[model samples]
Target: MKKLNCLIGAIIKDQNWAVIPFGNTILEPDDQVIIVTIPENASKIREMLEGGPVRTNHIMEE
Candidate 1:
């Protein structure tokens, strides 16, 4: 999660039905994440999580 911000500047502002995120926070199957980011990065992050993990820190899956 820390890498998500440090690498792409997108922030996980808050999440529903989940714990407050820390550096090692792990997203579950049904967790609804709230993020603050630009539209392009939002799309990229969505694609990565929905599709699969990618090499870039900009898109972290799980």
Candidate 2:
């Protein structure tokens, strides 16, 4: 089984809110998606979602 990490959130559509799960489900442009994916696939998921990882100042702070 593939382990998927997902973000639980609601999306507003036409004055209505809908719940979405991060998986193989189809998503609309105006729909809020909860990105659920595995650790190994995290890089791919991020790339697909927000184009790329958001740079943080604490990345190398440790």
Candidate 2 local lDDT, 1-62, one digit each (tens): 12224433444567685764655444454444344345666565454556323221111111
Put down candidate 1 lDDT per residue, 29-56, tens digits, no spaces: 4334555445656665565455433222
Q: In order, what lDDT does every prediction score?
A: 0.40, 0.42
**What's the lDDT for residue 34 in model 1?**
50
Q: After superposing candidate 2 on the true structure, give the runs of residues whose Cα lies further than 4 Å from its correct spot.
A: 1-23, 51-62
Please report how far candidate 2 places residue 15 from its true position, in Å.
10
Question: Could you give the C-alpha RMSD of every candidate to the true structure, in order shown?
Answer: 8.8, 8.5
Return the lDDT, model 2, position 7: 36
How big is the positional error of residue 25 in model 1, measured in Å on the Cα after superposition? Answer: 4.3
In terms of lDDT, the poorest run of 10 residues in model 1 is 1-10
